[model samples]
Target: MSPVLRAPLGRVMRWHRPLMLMVASMLLLVVVSVAGLAFDDRVLLGAPVWLKPFKFAVSMAVYGTTLAWMLSLPHRGRRWTSGLATVFAVAGFVDTAIVAIQAARGTFSHFNKSTASAERVMQVIFGNGVLCIMLANLALAIILAVQRVHADRAMSRAIHTGLGLAVLGMALGFLIPAQGTAQTALTTGGERVLLSSGHSVGVPDGGPGLPLTQWSTTGGDLRIPHFVGLHGLQFMLIAALLLAALAARHPLLRDDRLRARLIGVAATSYTGLIALLIWQALRAQPLIRPDALTLAAAALLAALTTLAAVAVLKAGRVSDGNPPAAQQANLDGGRVG
Candidate 1:
């Protein structure tokens, strides 16, 4: 890699050790899961058994990497941030490990109430593990919001907004188990127990789904919004980074306030999209099959976002060079004329 790139990469490498290790482990598991997919033809829920493991590994890896970078930022409460980050790392690892273990055992990992007590135990562990991660993440988000991390306004706004959206996304997962139908089943000991629920809405799980995501193609899949929400932090951070890069060529973007305002617009639009996806899923509509109402809502959101972005740019000051004489006079004579 070039020296310019290696310097930033090295800084990233120095992020919270536990979180980075968690990310590394997840990446290794991702490779193993892919190998399982290639060799093991076993199917679960109408998809490759290892697919869940792969997805969880990837998700956890991303989660860890983002968290690690966040913890690396110069902010107040280093002790608190580090402790919470460690907890999050452990919880995420345990969560992903449970999925991989259950997949290796050829049994359901999530919402598993199978006759086998082991599967039930694993499910309980997974639930608690996820809950722990969420709580730790919530605490970290609070810390980031309360403290000054980045000197650049645009990047700082992205970090804070991203963390907020990510917390909401993680919370959305709770809605999944809440919405599915409950049913009674007999255990191995002839005792009746209620199996929690599944991911699909308005239809049974394991139905026709999008290829790798396995999101139901025929009915609502809450995972759609949940997934999008969880990654909001990564997306927004990337957007801010891209805008920073564009500042080199674009004179308007050279203004930090303009870039921050643009990030705000992007964050608002992203949140709206998440809300639209959740609404569609709640209505038992498949993501790929949004109805007219959904389309209209989406168009409105896009138009509003475009307008807001344009307004921000128009109002933003030119930081890189002199403005036109007419514009300069208007700026100087504004409200005084």
Candidate 2:
């Protein structure tokens, strides 16, 4: 292939590549999320939108894959690893099925229109689904961290800390209720009778909102929190790439310019992506409009691309050093003279 075609093809592959299936899955989830927002009025469920439940289901799948991959890493026991992987997979499958069913029945907005009994049930089910996915992801991260402690202590520490923060953020989200005042007013005998109890149960005030406390808005949906929580995957994956970069610095791989280059690209791309996510979150000002978020995302992407170029160039210069094989052979032969 010509270099021009090759380059564009490579970029396409990178975007769609399952090089990290979990990350790829999350990207898909993000797309779904954007679509949900765009078509909020379509009513996939009785809820006011179609995308939220789908987003959650996608999250479960992404996290499930992460959990499974983490467990399969070397040094972890086969049995426990398999069991945990199974748990995550099963939970993800269940959540996906639930969301699909609700979506089919046009009940995605069901929360907005459910009666008291139906509303309670939906809340309980949704809450449990969230917990299942979060805990599964946390468990996988912990396992990876523990395994790395003895072999790659620095990497382990970084991953552990990042994962801990992610878990904390996700847990905080659970504490916030999804209820809205409008929903509550509709429920209690009030003038804003958007839907009767027979039609929809409406989310009560202080019900579960988004998962992250900082992202919640007075009348906004949980997209911001969902975005924040899911972005943890980016952090963990970047940490993994950074660890790989650090590993490449060891005499074992440093002389191999190609390996270093690959790691460099992976790390730089992920780091840029992380910055973009942060920018997106910041722009999603609950106090402001969504246009700010769009502009911030664009600007951050441009800036990140420039920075990544510089970082990759620097990483490629590691070949000007001692090779691992020569050093090892010299040590083994012990010909000091």
Candidate 3:
């Protein structure tokens, strides 16, 4: 059987991954969203006319697929989880609908408290939709935490850590909206222009950025870590799964407990790195800047990650052939940026 199936659900053995509806809907949105690119229409911010629709479409795909995968790790057959999954799927559609409609209307999707009744109504719809999606995620986290799903011990622990970190990342996102609604300014050809809510503290929003990511090469951008932390669960869990898979072929990772320990270390260090990124952004340091302090902090995080790898190697010393369990695989092939 498949490697994962080999480690069937222990106490919660009957569970399955209910990803069909969510996946199909997200794929449909993605397909429909592409047509927006062909239109010659309004630009809300500095991005293309279709940018919001495209971005939201992609976001829904990633969210649906990633959450589907994570949720699969827990109990599957229960009626409530299935219902919740369906509700979350609908929430994704609602999210995409609001963003797309706003884009088509040639207005901003966020931070634009327009006084017109129609505009206000649309904004309210968008805001309420976002809140619902966020709460759904929170509810998912709580369920996964309280209910245990049987898997390899190391894999299980890794999943828990990754999921928890993903939640933390989502929480950090609140900082963006909570900040003042001041528009960022950029200077070009001796003229000052305004940019979207990329939230630059030390430099302008529109600067030399890394292509599509638009993370400032010349300023501080909290979105970087916020993005990174948001994907924490997927990244860490992927590592655990890879290591678990490798154990079948490599003697070094045979002790699942050691793998679990390594995942824990990785998770702790990962959260630290996320915090460091946020701290750097708050300091208004450019993402691509080579300032000594930023370099040092980045170096430290790298070192810790490397050390964790070494620990994973030595972790096999116990050789109990078992331990705890883990999360994150390219997350059903989700993409960021």
Best by TM-score: 1
Clashing pairs in 1: none
Clash counts per candidate, in order, are: 0, 22, 17
CA deviation > 4 Å runs, candidate 3: 1-19, 38-42, 73-80, 184-198, 203-208, 318-337
lDDT of 2: 0.48
Best candidate (score: lDDT): 1
| TM-score of each candidate structure, all chains considered together | 0.89, 0.49, 0.77
lDDT of 1 by residue, 1-337 (tens): 9999999989988999999999999999999999999999877657888999999999989878888887777899999989999999998988899888877766667776776777767787889988998898899889888766898889999999999999989999999999876555342234454567878789877789998999999999899999999999999999999999999998789778789889999999999999999889888899889899999999999999999998888777533357878888998999687
Q: Rank the models by lDDT, top first.
A: 1, 3, 2
- Comparing 1 and 2 on lDDT, the stronger one: 1
lDDT (C-alpha) at residue 212 in model 3: 54
Question: Which order, best to worst by TM-score?
Answer: 1, 3, 2
What C-alpha lDDT values do all the predictions have? 0.87, 0.48, 0.66
Instruction: At residue 247, give the lDDT of candidate 1.
Output: 95
